[model samples]
Target: MATSISPLEVADCEVLHAIEQQAHSHPWSLPTIQSCFGGLYHNIGLYEANEIVGFAIVQQVIDEATLMDICVSPACQGKGYGKQLLKQVLEQAQHRGVKIMMLEVRASNQAAIALYLKLGFTETYRREGYYPTESGREDAIMMELTLT
Candidate 1:
């Protein structure tokens, strides 16, 4: 069992891309993923059996951190991998001295919202017309966690 987390390398782009594509209906572009590890943010990959299983991207601005993206491979979803990944990411952020963690999820993504709440995040506000939806725009529910 190769369950471990490592700082994502440029070489891990393909795996992250694959996981993103598989997990999101509106997947992020390759350039966006590359930009995450391009010196502006911190990115981590969850590896198992020498392969990537999930990833989290976080951008730090002073004491605040924005969890830009987090996703588990479609095949790995519902197996507690997402939970583990989220906990690890939060721990890492706290260890880095980040005081707050925030992220936005589509209002319809009940699973993600539930997980965030279970992890101590509270709803902050809603961003109307924030994300692209099949029909017009979808509201984004903002969630925040205070590490300290």
Candidate 2:
């Protein structure tokens, strides 16, 4: 499968929303997703044969960058697309002189935490009850990768 990564724009929000809904238990509202199109945020889409299969949203401020969100289509999960997409984001951030990359993940998301760890991120701390869950609230594990 021929795959590619490309910068995404506001026009791509609907497609992103679709994938977000499929991949996340509590997905962002379309308007919330739409608000990330510009400014300090740089969004990217992962495509296979020119069709979007995943996406990531990252925000940069000076030397620090935060990975705000990432998702691969449920059907496309476990194929390493998430890793590829995240690696691309890291590369782009490094190219722009970003010194550190940070992110927060649900404590229950072992797959995501493992992926982050594999990419050199180290857990820094945790926020208890930071994310709402069906049962109650879940902790948010904060991780960071030093790029410089």
Candidate 3:
């Protein structure tokens, strides 16, 4: 299937929120997602047949960028859409002259860690009990990819 990446618009908020709620155990609130617009944030959507299948939100400051949130629709998982979304975000960051990219993932998210590693990200630090979980809290693994 052919997929295209484009800047996320206000009209996409509801669809992206629905995807996020379906894709993650703890999804960002609609207001939080909406706040990604304007500012120094870049929000991109992966469209398949004019519908958003995946999305990413990145915040950039000077030469650095942070991958704040990324998700693929529940029905679209395991089909490389997440990777494509991340790739697009990386390309956008590089195009904007971002020198480094960083993100934090739940320590239990081995799949995401593996993907990041495969895409040239390195583990930089760990935050103990940074994420709330069903069983108390979970650690957060911090990773970074140097674009320069």
- For all predicted structures, in order, the TM-scores are 0.95, 0.98, 0.96
| Model 2: colliding residue pairs | none
C-alpha-based local distance difference test score of model 1: 0.89
Models sorted by lDDT, best on top = 2, 3, 1
- For model 1, the stretches where C-alpha displacement exceeds 4 angstroms are none
- lDDT per residue for candidate 2 within 2-89, as digits (tens), equals 7999999899999999999999999999999998877799899999989899999999999999999999999999999999999999
Query: Over 4 Å off in model 2, which ranges?
Result: none
How are the candidates ranked when ordered by TM-score, highest leading? 2, 3, 1
Report the error of model 1 at residue 40, Å. 3.8
Report residue 24 deviation for candidate 2 (angstroms): 0.3
Q: What is the overall TM-score of model 3 with all chains considered together?
A: 0.96
Tens-digit lDDT string for candidate 3 (1-148):
8889899887899999999999888889999999988879899999989889999999999999999999999898898998988988998899999999999999999889999999999999999999998879999999999996
lDDT (C-alpha) at residue 14 in model 3: 99
Question: Judged by TM-score, which candidate is best?
Answer: 2
